[model samples]
Each structure stands twice: as C-alpha cells, then as structure tokens.
Target chain A: MKRFFLSDLLAGLLFSLLGFYILFEIAYFPVDEGNIPGPRYWPRLIALGLILFGLWLAGSKIYSRRMTAIKPNLHHPHQRQVLTILVMTIFYILLWSLFGFFIPTVLFLLGTMFVLFPFQPKQKVRGSIRISIYSLLIALFVYGSFYLGLHVPLN
Target chain B: MDAILQAFVSLFQISNLLMLLAGVFLGMLIGALPGLTATMGVAIFTPLTFFAPPEQGLCLLLGIYTAAMFGGAISAILINTPGTPAAIATTLDGYPMAKKGEAGLALGLSALGSAGGGLFSVLVLALIAFPMARFALQFGPAEFFSLAVFGLSMMIAVSGGSIMKGLLLGLLGLFLATIGIDPIHGFNRFTFGIKELVGGVSFIPILVGLFGMSEVLNRILEGSLQDKVLRSKLGRVFPTKAEIKRVTPAFWLSSVIGVIVGVIPAAGGDIASLISWEQAKRFSKKKEEFGKGSMEGLVAAETANNAVIGGEMATMLTLGIPGDAVTAILIGSLMMWGLKPGPLLFQDHIDLVYQIIAILTVATLFSLVISLYRIQTLGKWILKLPDYILNPLVLLLCLVGSYAINNSLFDVWIMFGFGVLGFVFRKLKFPLGPIVLGLILGSMAEANLRRFLILADGNWFQFVFHPIALTLFVLSSLALLSSFKKAPSL
Candidate 1:
C-alpha cells in the first residue's frame, strides 16, 4: 500500500513535469492580440492548473496510506499459467505474421490446452483432447467467418 | 413520413437484411470477448463495408454498434471482466449475479433491457433526427469548441475512486492530444522528428495496446491461479414477465437519456450509461439492490449504450461531425464511398440517407434478435474456454488488427511498444484510459485552440468572453476541480 502511494506520488511528479514542458512550449509561441483570448492563454491556464493539481496529489499522498487487502482466491498461484499465456500470445503474433492466420491460431490453441490444463485424474486426457478438438473447430469457424465470410484479406 | 417510407423501401432488400444480421452476430462475438471493445470491432469492420452500397454498409455497421454494447454484458455476467468500458457499470451488478449462480437471469435481463432501449432510441431517431440536425447546423466553430470542452468534462463522471487519478489521466489525455503535427501550422509538436510521429499515434493501435495488451499483462502479473472457473448453468434466457414489467420504465428513461447525451459530439455511450445508471439509482425503489444483481442497473447501462448508436449516428448523418471515435471512422467509411454527410448531403442524396437510416433501424432490430437467440448458446460455451487458449489468440488478432489499420508493419511495432508502456503503467497503477484518450484527441484539441487563437488575434479573452466558449471553459474547470475533491486516497 505504501508502495502504491509512492508510485502515485511519482506519477504526479511526472505529470507536473509534463505540464511545465507544455507551458514552456506555449511560451515560445507568439501571442496574437486581436483575438479575445490568445492561443497560449487557455493551454497555459490548463497547464498551470495541472501543475498545481499534480503537486497537491503528490503532497497529499505522503500522509495517507491505509491499504485494504481483498482475500486471496484459491487460484492465486497460477503465475506460470499467466506467463505461459503471455509468451504464447507473443509467439502467436509472430507466427501469424510469418505463417498466415489459421495455422498459428490452431497451434496456439493446441499448445495452450496442452500446457495450462494438463491431464489430471479429475480432468481426463480424453476430455482435454476433446476440448482441444472443439477449440480447433471454434478457431476454424472464426477464421471462416472473419476471413472468408467477411473478406478481411488476412495476410 | 416520406423518409420513413423511403427507408422501408430501401431496407426491404434481402442483401441489406442479411448484412445486418451478419454485422450484429459478429459485433456480439467481438463485444463478448474481453478487451475487444465496440470501437475496435467497428474500426476493424468499417473498411469491409466499403464494397457495399452506403446504405447496406451502414446497416451492417449500425448492427454491430448496437449489438456490441449488449455483447459486453455477456462477459461481464459469466466472467468478472467487462468486454467494453460501457459495461464497467454492468459488471458491478452482473458479476455478483454470476457469483450467486444467476448468470442466466443476468443475461436475460440485459438482453431485454438492451432491446427495449434500442427500440425506444430508434423511435426517437425516427421522430427527431431531422429537427436535431437542423438545430446542430446553427453551431459555429466557437460553439463546436465549447461542445468539445463540455464533452471532455464528462471524464469526471467516469472517474471512480480517485478524482485526482481521473483528473491526472484526463490532463494526460489532453496533453497527448497535443502530440504530432499542429493542425494550424503543420509543425510537429512532440513527434521528435520520427516519421511515424508525424501522423501522431494511431487510435486503433493505442486502443488495442491499452485495453487488449494491458489486460494480458495484468493477467500475467496477477497470476490467474486463483480464478475459480464458475460454470454458469444455462437456464431460461428470458426475463420473467414481472421482471420485464418492473424494468420497462427504467428502459424508456435510459433510452431517452442515452439518445440525448449521445447526440452531443463529446458525450458517448459511457457517459450516457453513467447518467442513466445515476438516474435509475435515484428513481428505483429497489436502489439498494443496485451493484448487487439488480436487473434495473444492467438494463439501464445496456439500453443506454445501445441507444447511443442511433443518437450518435443522427449527428454524423445530419452534420459531418462524428459523435465519437467509431462514428469518426464511420464518417471516413462514408467518405470513402463518395458520400458526404451534412444538410447538403440530405438535400442532394436523400434516398441514400433514407436507405442508410432504414438499414440502421432494421439492423438494430436484427442485432437484438441475434443477441437474444444466437448468443445464448454460444455465450455458455465461450465462458468455459480457458483464458490461456483464448488470450493468445486475441493478442494475435490485436496484432493483425493494428497492422491492418494502414497495412503498415510499423503500426504493429507501435502497438507492441505501447503494449510494453501499457504494461509498465499497469504495474505502476497509472491509469491508461486517459493516455489513449489523450493520444486520440490531442491533435483536435491543439488544432482548435490554435484556430481560436488565430481568429482572436491572440487575445486571451476570446476563449473566455465568448458566451458558449466561456460556459465550456468554466464547466471544464469545475469538472477538473470537483474530481480532485472527490479522489479517494490510496
């Protein structure tokens, strides 16, 4: 929670810096006097307000740190499952770009099922295989719908 | 009446009806998938519509627009994640219902509410579109600028928990809007001389990164180990007569609010839903049941969001100005077909306008039917598919989606870069929504400010002294100030 507070403070400081940078840019622009309001006027005002607000956020968070944690669910430790999914996603993207759409999608679906929900006593190998086949069918169906049916011209 | 008859004649075409169904079905699927928002769905599909007649193409897009709003509720009910930002409010009540094993009931009420809202809004559009368009024609550049400011102020309404965070994000969005080439002088502001920066950041890529990639990264970091896969029992997918009767008034009210808010260039489905929910909460005798599986809340949000489609379209069709990002793309699609939008458009191409409106109305109905029937069975099956298999495929789609925008490999890389940035932001708990909004709106904001300055001869008073502009300036300031006061400290 303290880390969260500190991070927010840091974000506020970054925004404040950005606000000032904008202000600096506005300063360089020549102001036209004929118009009711100059071009830099409103932007400068907004920037000033943002700077003030950012400073306030950074200042106020220094004293307030009461973290309320929600109870951890049973599936909290599936970090590998998440990582595997992310890696698979990157692979899927690269594969799709190199080898076209359908092939990589099928491979991704099969690979994911094999890794994430590996056969267990309660979850039989047959069930996983059936799920994989069904997933493939769904993927193919989607491919046909989007690519063939809609003519997305997937490269 | 004449326009309605003409619209009917145009919509009666078999091809138009079929395309409407296709658009609705595809939109629902896209909406049901977490991170594939309605805007993204519309953006990806808008190009495909170019081959068809403008009416048929618009019919399909309208179908997608309406159905996608309802489609987001599917994931919100079965999974805790909202498929679209508009469904964020829906998830508050919907996920709880799913947890309590009332997923079927939640879906039923959502569909019913959505249909009611859609039907109501279409009727409004049918009756009021022309008049509204005529009124909107009176708006000058200064008025339009004020309108943008007013629209920007709604960010405060969406800011939940920390007003400071929301303001920070909103400002961040405004800053990002300033990036790329200045609209007035064509001088690059923040592109850093990068050729890719000249066009600024593409909305589609940034959106894909912020919503899709960030979600994947968040899931990875959070570690999906503890997610108990709740198998939602497929029950009767229709609300009871009693439930329908109770929600009828809320549906009507939300539709009215949705259309009114959506007609404004700055306000969108998200704001419309928020306003409707607030209104529903205020009026409902069962207000306590809200955020705890109240059908009224789901109905209000779903209906309002769907209703926004017609409302937003009214402005786009009558005036050339797009009400939201999706509409902006839709405007591009129409322009690609050599169809101009505005009063002159209606006068010169009345049949085309009528055909398009007819297609939209029919498509809205078609979207309702497909969402109610086709998605019920598919929704149950989709819920059971583990995210491990699904998330990767979505990422691929996102990559293709980004690349497909301009057929540039560079955009794909930009998407990946933003994805990494999004991940870092997520890790640091910095909100990403405003950043995307900023990037999308930056150029517009800067251009208008510059134009206003040029017109005013650099007089600072011009922005504040002009009646409409002054009101907007004050309103945006108040909105920013109020949001700061409401922030919940970490």
Candidate 2:
C-alpha cells in the first residue's frame, strides 16, 4: 500500500477526480456563441485533456508496477521535522495577521532555525543566544526594508 | 548606431551599474545554494524591481539571469551539489575534478566557458532578433494561436518524469488560469464570488511559493537542512595556454547547441547543458574522461547553460513568447512596466532593445572578471552556510514578497496554498515548468484561438490554409512525437 502510494497511481486518480469535478463545474458557464469559443470552451477542452492524460498516467504506472517486482524505498528521516515546521508556519501566519509582524516573525524565525539546527547538549545556551540575536536582526531587516523602505504595511 | 550609442550611455549610469553589480552578486549567492534554482532567485528578487525604472530593473534582473547560470558551477565543483538544475551536467566532471585537487582549475574553466558561450549567444541575438521580430510581426491571429500551441507542446521536453504527467499538469495550469474574467466575453467565470479571484491567481505569489517555499519544505523533508560539505582547496585558478587550446572545440560546439535549445520555448538551461555535454562527449577524443574529470565536459556544461541566457532573451524580446520559466517571469515584469515585447518594440523602443543587448554583454564580461578574481573564495564561503539559517531566511522572504504584491494577506495565503501544491507535485514526480508555461500562455492561446475562429467565420479548416500556422502546427506535432524517444539522463 505504501509502495502504491508512492507511485503515480495516486496522482493519476486524484487528477482524474479533479478533472471530473471541473467538467461538472464548467457546465454552469455559457455555451459558445456560434463559432467564437465561449468561456466554457477552453476549460472544457482542458478538463477533457486532464481526464485523458490522468487515465494514461494511472494505466501506465499500474502496468509497470505489475511488470516489476521491486518495491520503492520511501523512508524519510525528517518527516516529523517537516510536518512540525509546516504546522508552525500556519500558526506563524495566524499570529502575523492578528498580533502584527515583529514579535511573531522573530519567534517564528528563531524557532524554525532552532528546530533545523543539529542538537548539541553543551552548546545549547550559546546556540540559543546566537539564534535569538540572528532572528531579531533578520526580523528588523525585513521590517526596515519591506515595511519602512518599500512602504508595505506590515501592521 | 545612434540608438546603440545611447543604450551604452544609459547603461553606464551610476545607479543602473550599481544595481546590475548588486544583482550579479546576489544572483551568484542565490545560485550557489543547493536546491535554490535560478527561477527561484529571479522570482524572490522580482519585487525589488517594482521600485526602479524599467532600464534599471531590467539591468538588475538580467545581471541575475546571466550570473546565476555561471554561479551554479561553484557548488557543482566544490560540494558535488549542482546549485541550480542547469548545473546537473556540471557535476558530471566538476566534482571528480575537485576530488582530483584541481578545484580552482575547474572553476576557472567553467567561468571562461560560461562567458564565451554567453558572448556567442548575445552575438547571435544581435544578428537575429530584429529579423525574427519582423517575421513574427507578419503573424495573424491563426498564426499566433498556432505559435502558442507550439510553445505549449514544449511541455514534453521539460516534463521531468513522464509526458502524460506533464500534459495533465499543463492542463491544470490552464484551468487555474481560466478562473478570472473571460478574455472574449465580459462574463466572470469560476470566481466563486471571491473578489481576489476576479483578477486571476497572482503570478508572483504562485511563482515564489512553488519555487521558494516548497523548496524549503522539500529540503526539510530530505533531511538536508544542515549540509555537511567537505571543503576543497582552491589551487591555481587560471588555465594554461595548452589547456585553453584543448577546450576550444568544446566551447564552440556547446555554445551553438545552447543557443538553438534556448530559442525553443520551455527548453531551458538544464536541457541545453545536458544536450551540449552529450554532443561534446561524442566529438571529444578523450571521451572516456567525459564523465570522470574531463575539462571539456565541465566547460561544455557551464558554457551551454550560460549561453541559454542570450537565446532566451532573443525569443522573449522578439516574439513575446518566453523561452523558459525565468523568462516567463521576465515577460510579466515587462508587462508590468507597460512595455509589450514584439515587433512593435523594435519600432517603438529600439533603444531599450539595444540596451538589453549591451546589458547582456557587459554582464557577461563583469561576471567573468569577478569569477577570475574572487569566485573561489566566494564559493567556499557559500558552501559553509548551513541550510538551517538559509531556509528560514528564504521562507521569510517568501512570506513578505508575496504580501508586498497587492498589500494583502490574501496573496500570502494563495502563495502558501501553491507552495503546498508544489511540494505535493514534486513528490509525485510531476514537472512544475509545464504548469508555469501553461499559466503564462493560456490566455494568449485562448484569446487568439477565438479570434482566429471569428476571422475565419466558423470555418476551423481555414487554419490549415495559413502557411505559417500550418508550419507551426506541424512543428508542434513533431515535438510531441519526439517525446516518445528516451530523454537525456539528469
């Protein structure tokens, strides 16, 4: 099942499903005006393409999987780290909208960097201070350049 | 001649020159980082150009485009990581040469090859662009539609894994592009009542997200967040007279190949370098050393990739069709500056076109001079920077840059959504380039298609009567058929 998930079969199925949905949705758009292609014509053509190619991908992948006996190795060491960072970023964006830029941005930067950095028990204090300072400086720079210089309203 | 003189005069302005230098320096830095691409470098820095005049902005972007192509070689030699996708071929011989303790020599050869190739392609552009623009000006609606079809057919070449997957993604991009107001009719379609959707999905946000934020995520997932690169010593940087003579044939062959591929829509530096490297290998007497540590191979790859910049610019400037993803963004930038690229550009803004030529030439020379002086030290320093620090910084820029476009958090959200999609797409081995091309060309194709139909009065067969349209359609078919052949290995 894991091997199947890693294959193009899943992608094909998903795309084909999306294609059907698009086909259904574009039905609401008005039909072509005589010869001139209306709004629906282009999308209808694209949706049909999606269906055709999506089926092709899935069919090809399935055939290849049957022909071959080897299973793909899908191990990833940093899955947890990646997921954690993604979730953290969501929170960071939320905080950014509600509380404004500096504090949330500085914390997000410092926290992400710390999470990414290799662990060292003895150097934790030093590393923490350095990361904090770097985060603060980065935040300030982005704030100054984007907010102050370019006049982008961060608040 | 007077326009050329005025171009040079404008180019030498203190602010323009300074921006060009800064863009070159920044491009090099961005290109030296593994996983960050030339497209990403251009996209991330695009917002900065919004503040400047068209000339200065173009200079800045062109500097980045030219320098980044060369900059990828730095990591390829030192860390065995091709900093940009274009440098994938560079790693074939670059890493091996570095291992043999000739890192400096490899770097020097790469810089020389890059500058030589870039200059050759620029010469071709100067000779060909005006004529090409004149020819393209003759195209009617049918011919234009067929040309767009031809451009979209290139999806197969850029499709990394499978042609089917590429076509599907291309369709998806086309669908996404149709969300805004219809080009022919005034009716709104697929907006779902969201005000932001009426203007269509913002190109920059999607671009930055797909190339930037998704890259950060992918790096994290790959556990390459803290790269432990083994440092290589920089030895003698300059090549000997005999060595230069040995590589002369490769330089010529690769540059020609580079320009040809670069002129084709959707075919970029990565494809150009791979093809050039293969061709050089076929011609080289020392073919056995082609992938081991051959100077010819390194020079071929670097030269071909840089040469692509000129050919890409030629197509973009003359036909208003992007040659690759980076040029696609550049087209958007040009549009933002209220300048339409095509035959009329030659008639109306010939001075600007001349300035572009001058910028490309000067940028090549400047990058070479800098590479000769200090690229070795710069490469070493870049290799030492940890991804932990770099990734976060990039994410910050992605967030801010996306928001800066419309001064709305909505664009940022759109970027985040696309970033997630980009990551998922990558995991599925889908090509992102097709999506970009599809998005960029969708409206043009759709609009022209309808116009051609109207002009022909409901007779679709009239398309076959137009010689240029028929030729383009034939070429598109051939390109699609050629996709069945085995692609060059990365």
Candidate 3:
C-alpha cells in the first residue's frame, strides 16, 4: 500500500499551481503607464507571495515528515454520506435554476432529511411522512418570505 | 440643554415611538439572520424614511443601526456562525461558551456589552465629534495604506498554530481582491472574461460560505446526525456581580477601540471587533482562555462592534465622510432630506444634532431591553432544534443569503465553491480567519498604496516621513515579529 501526507502536500501543490497560473495570466496585463505603478504591480506582488509561501509550506511539511514517522488518517466513516449530500446539493441547484424555487427546494430538503435522519427499521413510513411534511413547511416558509414578502423572485 | 429637552420631547410622539420600535424589531431580525447585514437593512429602509419627517426618520434608522449590531451576537452565540461579519470575533469565544452550557449568559453579556459600548460611543459623539472627525480627516492615502498594513499584521495573530498556512491564505485573499478593474487606471486585471467578475467577488457570499455553509458541511462530515442529543445547553442568562466586575474594563477599553476604528473612514465594526479581541487577549489575565471561551474576549468583541455605530455617525454627521458602508447609505439618505452633513450644517442645525443624539441614546437603551428580554427564550429555542433539521435550515439560509446579495446565481455558485474550499481548508488545518482579514483589507491596502505612490511620485520611502504612517509601520513590524514567539508549531 502506498501512503503519503495528502493534506499539506495537496494544499501546497494547489496553491503553487494557482500562483503560477496567476503569474502567467497577469503577464498580459498592461504595464506601468507613467510614474504610477500599473495593475500588475499589486497582483504581481501577491502572486510572488503565493509562490514563496506555497514552497515554504511544502518544504516545511517535507522536513517535518522526515523527522516523524506517523501515519496520516485519510478515510472518513461518512465519506459516502458526504458525497451523497454534495451530489444532491448540486442537483438541487440545477433543478432550482431549471424548475424555479418551490419544487426543487422541497425535494432537496426531503432528500437531505432522509439521508440525515436516524435509521429505525420499524418506523420507515413514519419517518418518511414526517420528513415530507417538514420539508414542505420549510420550502413554503422560505418561498413566502423571499418571493412574496421580500420580493426576491426566487427563480 | 433646551434643545436636548425639545429633542427628548419630540421622541414621545406616538408615530415616532412606533417607528422606532418597528425599526428595532426589524433590525434584530435582519441582524440575527446570516448574510443579511446592517448595511443591507439600512439601505433597504432608506427609501421609506424619505416619506417621513426628519426626526422620525432619523429615529427609525438609528434604531435599526443600534439594534442590528447587538442582534448579530445572537446568532454568533447560538450557532458557530456569525450573523453579521461584525460578529466574526464573537464566534471566537461565544460559540465555545454556548457549547459549554452558557448560551444564555453569552447572549445576555453580549447584549449588555453592546449597549454599554453604544452608550459610550454616543457620549464620545456628543462631546468630541468635531475633534474626532477632524482627526479622521487627517488620514490621507499614505496614512490609510499604513493603517491597512497594520490591519494585515493582525492576520499573523489570527493565524492560529500555522502562521505559514495562514499567511498563504491571506495572500490568496489579497490576490482575489485584484480580480476587478484596477482602482486607479480602470483597467480590468483578472475578470477572466466574466462581466460579473468586474465587480470583483462579493464579500457577503464569501463570508456566508466560509463561516456559515462551511460550518454546516463540517458538521455533516463529522456525522453530527448520528448524535441523538443536541450539544448546546441552556444556562443562566445574566452575569454575576463578579463576572461583570471582571469584564467591565474590557467593555470600556474595547468601546474606545471601536470608536477610534469606527471614526476611521473605510474601517468598520468587523475590524474594530478583531482588533479589540486581540488587544483584550494581550491585556487579559486569562490570555490562554481567549479563543477557548474567555468572557473578556466575548465582551470586547460585542461591545466594540456595536460601539462602531456611534463613531460612524459622528464622522458622517460632522465631516460628510462615511465611516463604513452603512454610514455611506446614511449620508445619501440625509442628502435626500436636503440635510447637508458638515460643520456649516451643524451650526445651522444644532437642534437636529441634539435630536440625533437623543434618538441614538433611546435606540441603544431600547435595543438593550429587547435583547435582554429575548435572550433566554431565543437561546432555548435554538438549542431545542435537532442537528438534522437545524443543519438543513442553516444551509438553506446560506443559499438564500448568498443569492439575495446580488440576485445573481453566480454569487450562489461562488458561495457553494467557497463552502467546499473552506471545508477543505478546515480539514487541512489551515486557519480561516486570516483569509477573511486579507479579503477585508486587500483593496484598501492596494488602492491607497497606489494613490500614495502617485502622491509621492513613486518615492515609497517618503511614506515613513508622515508621523502616523511611521508609527503604524513600526506597530505592524512589532506585531509581525511578535507572531513568531506566540504562534505554536505544527
């Protein structure tokens, strides 16, 4: 089995790549027009800072890892649950944009509640009914406040 | 004295009193909801005030401003989320205190501290507004740049155990601030071909995502649903005599910090609260307990944030300069009423100034009474809600709040993205506070530095010659240097 310190290394790598990308993009920015420094100055300074700090973070982590032989815990018990919620939320947003606010919000709320609710094998029907009513109420309350009262046009 | 008497009498009108009460109630609701800020509340109601008489209108707006600052502490204490950005520092000790079965006491103390700070700032406004406004006007581009540098140095203090990771995120926030058109040349830098990016990132969405949505995500990942019992425990609402005695000095000190920071144009409650929290920690006997639920830290944050309203009012009324976003909207509203705000207007409308002071005092007192009355009931109600139901509701609010900011789905997407980003940062042990600090001070730092450079003909060294700027630079260096000794190792 292969193992590595994913958290620190990944963060360092992510930031370093972002820094390089920003540096690349800002190259096209107009240079100093006169005595005043141009748009590139501030961004350039920050981009350089990102690069330096990213390397420092990664370098420090590597040094620390060499000194300590500790195994990192990478797996979470509820990874599947977290994934389901994230995917469901994405669908909720998509449905929201397509079909407006009411139906999507109710569906999203119901789905999340079902996933999050404590499992009792004997009371599935009751749990479903309770979650359905709660979801409907929340959606309606949200709709009334945002769409009717505040006039947010929740489309 | 006669004008003060007349002003107090004017507040007794049935219509005026109703408007004040309504504003206070509405402001509490707005402030307790995450993403709905005091600025938004004031901006939304500004138009309504145009139809009312001067005294009544001022009363309503001032009531909202006063109560909203206090209201933010409600959500911060109850949940780990801050209702408003001004309450960011409140989450440091407030949430811990809530989790420790002192939710009631936290809310009560927050309300009292907020009222105390509000009253103190109002006194300052009444007695020394002219001098304070004059001092605020002395902050030119160079001075503002220096102040922002000092503000950025606080990122080191807030970085928690990992200063390197904190500074990295802070730099990233600064980079994000440069996405819009350049401040001086009007040249687009990093819009990435999106028209919405021209406005740069909206801070409210970022804030909601980072603090509110991320919290929900973290709870879910921790399998909070499996726990049958809610964690928060309702306890005593009021502080004991000894507790009050311990926190009184913090209240006074932070109130002064809040007023000074508030009087500075472009600085607001958020910055004041942060500085107050740090300074309180430095001076406290319980320094180690600061982030772990120190009463002094909580009192300092709440008091400072609420106190900012008075200093902002003073600056707006005396110098025609807005101290923050809410005050900027207030200035526009006053102009709509044909009430010019500068020295000449004060001489011409001394009676109106007296009336404003009267309105502010009453509003502070009214807010305190309402907050104290509701603290226990609100804390109990929130603690009663289950994690499954409450987490979903919080997520919904986060979505709605982010969307409500610009009526743009892009902002919603930004919120979702940052929520995920914040969750990752949390998992990776990076401190979130410095990122926020960077975002808040970034543009101010960049724009003022450029302006100062232009003023000095690119002579950067000339900045040190200014006494205030020099002093701020020295303070910033000292703060950053101190971080090395204070920050814990990974």
On DockQ, the leading prediction is: 2
Q: Order of all candidates by TM-score, from best down to worst?
A: 2, 1, 3
TM-score of chain A of each: 0.62, 0.87, 0.87
> Docking category for candidate 3?
acceptable
lDDT of 3 by residue, B111-203 (tens): 999999999998888888767545656678888788667756655554466777877888887887788888888998788799999978776
Cα error, candidate 1, residue B233 (Å): 6.3
For candidate 3, the lDDT comes to 0.78
> What is the CA-based DockQ of model 3?
0.43
Q: What lDDT tens digits, residue by residue, belong to model 2 across residues A126-155? A: 888888998999999999999888788898
Question: Taking the candidates one at a time, how many backbone clashes does each contain?
Answer: 26, 0, 0
On lDDT, the stronger of 2 and 3 is 2
Q: What is the TM-score of each candidate against the true structure?
A: 0.77, 0.95, 0.71
DockQ of the two-chain complex in candidate 1 = 0.30
Top lDDT: which candidate number? 2
By lDDT, is 1 or 3 better? Answer: 3
Listing every candidate in turn, what is its Cα RMSD in Å to the true structure after a full C-alpha superposition? 5.5, 2.6, 7.2
DockQ for all models, in order? 0.30, 0.58, 0.43
Check candidate 2 and list the clashing pairs.
none
lDDT, candidate 2, equals: 0.85
Write candidate 1's Cα lDDT for B384-469 as tens digits. Answer: 55655555555656666676657666677777777766776666555554554444444455566667666777655766666866
User: Candidate 3's residue-wise lDDT over A22-109, tens digit each?
Assistant: 8899899888867788888888888888888888777777776643333434365466556677788888888988998889999999
Model 2: which docking level applies? medium
